[model samples]
Target: MLSIVPRHYFLGFIPLAAGAELITVFGVVNKASGIYGLLSIFTGHPITAAQLVLNIISLILLPVFLYALHSVRRQQALPVVAFSYVYFLDMLANLAFTIYFSVTWFRVFDATATAEAGKGTASSLDTASERGLSITIIVLALLFKVYFCFVLFGYARMLVRKAGLRSDNGEGKYMKQLQFIMLAIAPSFWRRGGRRAGKGRMVNTLEEGIEMY
Candidate 1:
């Protein structure tokens, strides 16, 4: 089911594309002089904008990363399931951020002032609305970041374990390589699978599949 050379490099760009969507959403907030103003001071744009740019960079490097992952996967990498779970968490985090931003923006913009008018009653109302929305996004982002960090650390541990396994395995050259690759980024696949880690039984079941394979 796997190919030595990926059938399409575009698949590697999926994360980047998703990141771009986030940038677009953030742009809306930036134009309104919301959190983007504060973010621009440090990141040259809002955090969301920075993330979008980083995503583009990641997209450019995805092919190489995927190749490396393919190599690892073929070797039956370690912490396979756990690593995949982390990637899944990362994607979900991004999606959650997007949804939260979108909803908050809509809430802020509903029946606000027009884009024209430089300074007036309408402008003040718009600013107030934007500020409220910004606060909400900030809080949500922090919460998500904390949750995501936990997942990231867990995934990192799995990756470290997988790396150790690679040294021990000596068979199935191509398969082992593919296995390693899959484990390396297995979190992304797990996220795509839409499975939750909250359920202990389900998590265990998924981990078993990763271990057995």
Candidate 2:
């Protein structure tokens, strides 16, 4: 399996992958809001109870995202590895939830389309196009998630490698397991582009001279 080490997170600048981590924090906020909505739904009826539980589990795992972000800011190696693992797992859980919700949404939409068509207010062609658009958006979002996971795991690998950590050490072995799992789950398309980040270039340019005393 090929290892993915991105050259830069966005564009040709932004040395570290922390930008993605920050974006991930916002994503977690969105997920938490979504979970709240799902919980509300569960209150009215027992529907989607399983999704509620899965989302709660995912939310419970999110504190590490914050912890890891802080550690990455401090340039700590081990905690970054843990952050990478939490991110990978969170991506998987979210993928499952996204798929389930998309399917359920389409089912409900189809039923609604049937009702509207019976009243001659909805055109079948218009409904089909709308459904197609929704599918395209979902696919694009999932692809982005896969690529984001690649960026995160690569960033962690870069830190571990730079810190002179031995692969036989506990953290190293755990990271290797994560890499293996990502390689198994990620599609081939996720491997293309963004590997140009040079070695030792991860430190932000703005913070370059602050450590000297």
Top-TM-score structure, candidate number: 2
The runs of at least 3 residues in candidate 1 whose Cα sits more than 4 Å from the true structure, single-residue gaps closed, are 1-130, 133-135, 142-150, 153-163, 167-175, 182-213
| Superposition error at 49 for model 2 (Å) | 0.4
Q: What TM-score do all the candidates reach, one by one?
A: 0.29, 0.69
lDDT (CA) for every model shown? 0.45, 0.66
Q: lDDT score of model 1? A: 0.45
Number of clashes in every candidate structure?
24, 2
For candidate 2, the C-alpha RMSD (Å) to the true structure equals: 10.3
Alpha-carbon shift of residue 98 in model 2 (angstroms): 1.3
Task: Please identify model 2 stretches exceeding 4 Å from their true place.
Answer: 1-5, 34-47, 169-213
Distance from true position, residue 199, model 2, in Å?
20
Q: Write the per-residue lDDT of candidate 2 for residues 1-213, one digit (tens) a residue.
A: 344446456323665566656656765576566467566774785556766677677567566666766777777766776676677777897888888899899999999999999999999999999999999999999887777776666666566566744333334566766544543443232233323332233455435766663
